[model samples]
Target: MISGEQRVDPELTTVIESVVGGTPCANSGEFHYSLAERRWEWSDDLARMFGYEPGTVRPTTELLLSHQHPDDRATGEAVIHRVEDGEPFCGRHRIIDTADRVREVIVIGDYESDDQGTVVGTTGFYIDLTDALEEERNDALDNVLPETIAARAPIEQAKGILALIYGLNSEQAFAVLKWRSQHTNTKLRALAARLVEEARQFDPNSPGARTRFDHVLLTVHELVDPAADAS
Candidate 1:
């Protein structure tokens, strides 16, 4: 059992390691903050995600908050403050790394406790969804499509569109598309093609992008011909 002042707990570390290992994407890393010690620990992957060399720079609350995107700083700060107060942390936000790259990430964690069950700190992981989505897009582009281009291109593009708009992982995005296809009684390819075409009209960086996409996603299937085999 870990004592209140213990810097590291082997058993807790093992559990964290197992979770990171089992994650579908390699774009995730663990973190721990010791409230009593006011110390922070970060995995190498997390450091890289923040555009820092592992062990080269110290991790502090200010440094962490500084990396948050301008629009998301308030949300990030709230999560940090809550964690500092021994509360669980779970938030999806954006960060601007050292190289000025924007990354969307999900941070999930719970309060860490000592042997006597006193809250000692917070432990959690960050999943870099932007990187994962980009990788998925690249992989889709690299795939060898069978026969007609109509068979795969629209579906892949549509999946990417949904993933970004809904903050969904690749599998979840695909499942949603399949569900929509079934419910609308439209061919998957046709539905995807219509979605992709509609999505093309919106500027993703705009404030209303999500709202526009939400409307498009809900009604794009209506535009697709149910009898069409290819979009």
Candidate 2:
């Protein structure tokens, strides 16, 4: 069932787990595959991400494919083929965990090769985006109440503002806002409320409000895109 052989890199796993720990999304893991042996290796976090006990199961491409949501299997196989061809892989897919819960995930990886330029393996990280995906879907559903729409209007506006200012897509913008909410020990809605309120009071021509707004912008940028700051 394994599309190809893969193996886990312990050092890479440790590094990735450490990196993910400080992010807004903690449900993520690192994976490696060995093309020569047709084997797979998974980090403990990756194993648990798929609802498996760490080291309890021998990882394989087939096993990973089996956990994918039925409709995503073809895309998943296509990703594997790309990896085998020594190309970088980036895709969003759905996985049915052992608990039978369908989780949305984003996987990003690159090939590993030797001096001869032969692709030996691939490595990457999978991050769970189920909560965000569900929220977006719920917002789009027609069954929502009028009051619910009214309540979400300000938050959606705030998200748009963040997206525009930060050059982020809607989901990443919301994630940045959510991360700020948690880091500051504020309720998500309450924090969003403040964002809206602050913008409401802004006087575009006044340097004072602009300076204050700049502070908020800097704080959000720091949290949401620390990698950018690092560079």
Candidate 3:
């Protein structure tokens, strides 16, 4: 458990909550894995997502891998191995829950360090995108336009950054970018451009990169020039 001084920023937490709440089809929750202890901790929502009643069962790496779709089990195991080796953990894959329902999810996390500044584990989010996929497919079909091709470059780059950091597919990544654009009152292209520029400086391998990127993603809108967008 995090101490008061080490707690995440309330505003940042609110932003994440809003993002999860705003979408009816998206179910998301936080998780942590302690490297030294080889232990897993799941939020109640995550437990529910796995078709288990909260607090009813212990979360373990083996339990997590057992839930992976047969075809994706190797991929899931590799992600855990990478995290164990002190690398960022990011995976977009499918899993079969206790109810025998298949769900697609994204696991995005970064290294967690102890008070001594030693990397101790990993912490991040699990985002279920099963229902959202159909919605995004319909939106994609409706929005394709020849004229929009010119603006796709930076937007695509921004989407890639979001995908890598958040473990979202291209569609979900675009949805996040669009959400930020609308809420921040920033033009979509301008917002994407700003995000791409800022992300260029982010090094995923660096210590504390995940927390820093979270701040950047939440507040980058403030850095965009409205007048420039207007032009």
Superposed on all Cα atoms, the candidates' RMSDs to the truth, in angstroms, are 11.4, 13.1, 8.3
Q: Where does candidate 3 stray beyond 4 Å? A: 1-15, 22-26, 140-157, 160-231
Per-model CA lDDT versus the true structure:
0.69, 0.60, 0.68
Checking candidate 1 for backbone clashes, the offending pairs are: none
Minimum summed lDDT over a 10-residue window in model 2 is located at: 221-230
Which lDDT tens digits does candidate 2 get at residues 1-231? Answer: 122333443444443444355454447777777777766677677788888887689976678778978998876776767656656655667899999999877665666767796778877677676765555444433232343346667567667655444333455556555544543445566566567666666665675553465455424322333332233
Off by over 4 Å in 2: 1-26, 134-231
**Is 2 or 3 the stronger prediction by lDDT?**
3
Q: Is candidate 1 or candidate 2 better by TM-score?
A: 1
TM-score of 2: 0.51
Q: Candidate 1's residue-wise lDDT over 40-66, tens digit each?
A: 778788888899888788888899999
Candidate 3: lDDT over CA atoms? 0.68
